[model samples]
Target: SSEVQMPMQSGRDYSLGEYFVEVKVGTPGQPFWLVADTGSEFTWFNCHHHKARNKTRTRHGHGHGHAHGHSHGHSNPCEGVFCPHKSLSFETVTCGSKKCRVDLSELFSLSFCPKPSDPCLYDISYADGSSAKGFFGTDTITVDPQNRKHGALTNLTIGCSKSMQNGVNFNQDTGGILGLGYGKDSFVDKAGRQYGAKFSYCLVDHLSHRDISSYLTLGPHHPAKLLGEIKRTELILFPPFYGVNVVGISIGGQMLKIPHHVWDFTAQGGTIIDSGTTLTGLRLQAYEPVLEALTKPLTKVVRVPGDDFGTLDFCFKSEGFDESVVPRFAFHFTGGARFEPPVKSYIIDVAPQVKCIGIMPIAGNSGASVIGNIMQQNHLWEFDFSQNHVAFAPSTCT
Candidate 1:
């Protein structure tokens, strides 16, 4: 079985809303910071206009490592480093290819293709009205091994994005997004095929200083085994997303009386584990009960007067407010998996001297609930795809 270990650094963006990871691509390995998104399936990066001359060099065991030699250094403020076309092993998929005709159409629109022999181009539109247009290609992606020896995953499918529209800006030190979703083309699925379908990650606190770091390990070298008393839950198989049966949520040991349909997977209403989302999102059916249970107890404390900030609903004044008043939340999943997130995970600091309940309510009744990255902070999450199970354990994540 293929096994690889890579260190993961987690930090808040300028808006303090998203988490991203640094990835090295191309031959000489140009490092690019990308959003680690479990909700998406396509890995893409911004491209530049300037081209570079290829010069072969050896770094890791792979001899294909080559650095780009260029003098007319025109830089892009958004992309930073352009795709080293000449130095990297790259190929564009044709529009008539099996991958483009079948798998690509599931996540992206293929209407832009002018000819069947042309490159398989795609346009991915997000719920936030942001979009990315690009063509599919395969290349090498290098990951810095913990032991200092260079490691790489070769011939990986990636998106060579040509343009971004609307809110899809790469200004926050982010080159693109690393898709870890369950789709066939996603990084997790592609790597899982060789790595025995197992992967794990330890997430640090969202509010933690930038100096702190974490780990995202693939295959058998999981870190959760060292943490002790692992709680296992069945990983509900939902294509293109990691779904789990979140039976109910309990606050301070009291189980909230939520409707059964709120947790029904057959109804297209269930919980998924997503790293891209910053806050937990529960369907309106479930969110109301959870919000009532959490807010009813906090009435004695001073409430901050503010309108809904972005997706957040419950905001409170942080001045002289004791966080101990907030209760611990435990998520009960199928197969006896119980996740008890620390108080800081749910009640989060959004601004200076202001904290808010980090859970958001999905407007519609048919949408799936999301267990966002914020709720998984300071914990080890192990995805055992081969065994169809996911294990979790509390951890410092450093």
Candidate 2:
């Protein structure tokens, strides 16, 4: 099997926004910035509709580690530069096929189909009320391997979204999302079958300067020699999400006395590592004790009054803040993998002199906790699907 590794750079959209990677789609190879999401399964891109009345010409431009361009004065934005009709290698998957009827039925909706011979359409509704409607197709996707060699994967499954609603507020500059989930149609699974089932990424600090960048590699690769001691943990198999068994959490060396059921997967509570989510989320049962333990150590710091930033509940005025006093948090997972995140990862700066706890609490009794991108910063995370293990080490990603 061939080995491939690609260097990915972070996006400049927002500090809390998803990480973006440059990918060339279609035969002629038009570049686009795609959100790198391990929580999703289907890889989709905005498509240019020929019959659509409002058509805007897209001019490609490079900015902030991504190749993206935009145009105004049009009511509806053009899907993107690559049009399926223009791509010679593009092929639409017809409805009623095995891939469309069975495989896709589990991941997407087929309620609006008109005929069996029609293109396999999908309507994906997200938990945040964002939706994308599109037809399934296949085309070429090109990426630059770490060996400095250009490689193109042909006939890859992709969704050419005809319409999207309130999903990430995509403009002409933003193309679409690239799914890296464990589903059969995911890019990670497909590429893993062809190449190797190992991928690793090092995320820079979210508050890092725009010029600083991180890296993402596909296929077999080793961490840089300068990285700290690497830790290995079992990668729990959870569809569409990479889960890890979190046994307990500790603040300042004292473990919180949370219930074991809060970390049980069978009880609808477990921890999942997701790059799409900005902030880490915990169930109410686990969140309360963790928050209490965190706040107890910060008695010296003055709490900001009436400072609420949506999901973030803990806020403080950082006028004369000393970060050295902040308590360190350690997340203990099954197999004895202890993840100790830096204090800066939890106490994030949202505004000038305003810092808040980056983790949020999920309002449900039954749902998986999420280790969001912010919590994973400044660490090298490697996902080994073939071996069913994930490894991490502290690193200065930039």
Candidate 3:
């Protein structure tokens, strides 16, 4: 694939869309705009559309992400594929005002619409198999005035989902997601075509605690050196969906054999390399060996949380470090190429005096394990479906 030119400025650093900071939402009395999510393109948020709502101050109550006077077991807003004007996550639908409207990508053009009677409902699906219903409309957006990275507005589109994911871990205050992906239909790419290209980002380590400046690098503004120089790693681009490949795994310089499985590629589909995702999920066949590698150190000291997938370390609450051992993961791509994560890449936090078990535990998993951006941060990854391969060139993300 031909290299893309991405422009950059001196002291002022930014790619295309927003990053780091988030905006808060709600009415004047209420604070916050919304946290923008490039991982998601369409924008939507909890609304005030409930008939039982304080119809006086709050306008539309019975909304998307927020449920007022609702029950979980009784009603599910996302019951059907298409929601015209009826859906509630945990609320008893006393009123009829839940519908999806408009395409988020067309939001900017959607404003000052030469037409009025057009429908604005849209259905959005996430990588986790969750869906939401919302409308696309132009609304005023404001970033923190003090923060330069948050203040500058380049190419962005916001959408509000009257409804959103029920049981998930994301900034719920979001009106909706700000998607910056490969599809030409996304708002960021659509609006900033001249400056945008396939999306790219680099995640800082959890330990670095460094400013996680993962910007969406787009357009012809990148450094010429990045384009002129060439470093290519052999990659066999699988189908776009949840395409997970456990080509090979290694621990402490020892190789472990495992089965390979792919993830969903298409929309609401399979797994691919997602820079935005935080954890790297692998299938059971791949999970077992990796988990065993993780458990080897602290079987007696660290309490193992047992489940179908067995003991996996996803803890906000931990007793203490069982052992202070540095681990590694090496992935063998197609051909003779191999990727060995540096100690800093897998370690929990790299700052002085902080040590962590770089591996997580899982009993078994069917969902695709993600090689998230954190894993790819040091490498300049190039995904070219057109060429049937994705290449990675090592870099510090300068």
lDDT of 3 by residue, 1-398 (tens): 22232221111122211123233222111223232343444544555432433435443544633453355656754331123233221221111222212333333222322334443555566654556654543332323332333322222333445666642324343333444444344444443443334434333333333243333343323231232243333333332221333357788778787644432332222235654444455655665677677557544453333232222252221345533454666776555456665655554332234433344323344454566544554555554333444555555554
RMSD of 2: 5.8
lDDT, candidate 2, residue 138? 86
Residue 89 local lDDT, model 3: 18
Off by over 4 Å in 2: 14-16, 52-81, 145-147, 167-173, 222-226, 305-308
lDDT of 1 by residue, 252-317 (tens): 889988888888889878888988777798989788888888887788666765464666777887
lDDT of each: 0.74, 0.76, 0.41
For residues 1-398, write the lDDT of model 2, one tens digit per residue: 36555545555444435677778887767677687777788788888744422234332321212212233334334345457765778888888678888778876947455777778988887654677888898898876533266677778889888778864424345578788778865688767766688888887776665466666677787444336788989999798889998989999888999889888899988899987777798899889998888877677777775345666788888888888887899999888989998998888877778888888888878998899888988898889987899888998876
Task: List candidate 1 stretches off by more than 4 Å.
Answer: 13-16, 49-79, 145-149, 166-172, 224-228, 306-308
Query: Model 3, residue 84: what's the lDDT?
Result: 24
Instruction: Please tell me which model should have the higher TM-score, number 1 or number 3.
Output: 1
All candidates: TM-score:
0.87, 0.87, 0.54
* Model 1: residue 49 alpha-carbon error in angstroms: 5.0
Sliding window of 10 residues with minimal summed lDDT for model 2: 59-68
Candidate 2: the clashing residue pairs are none
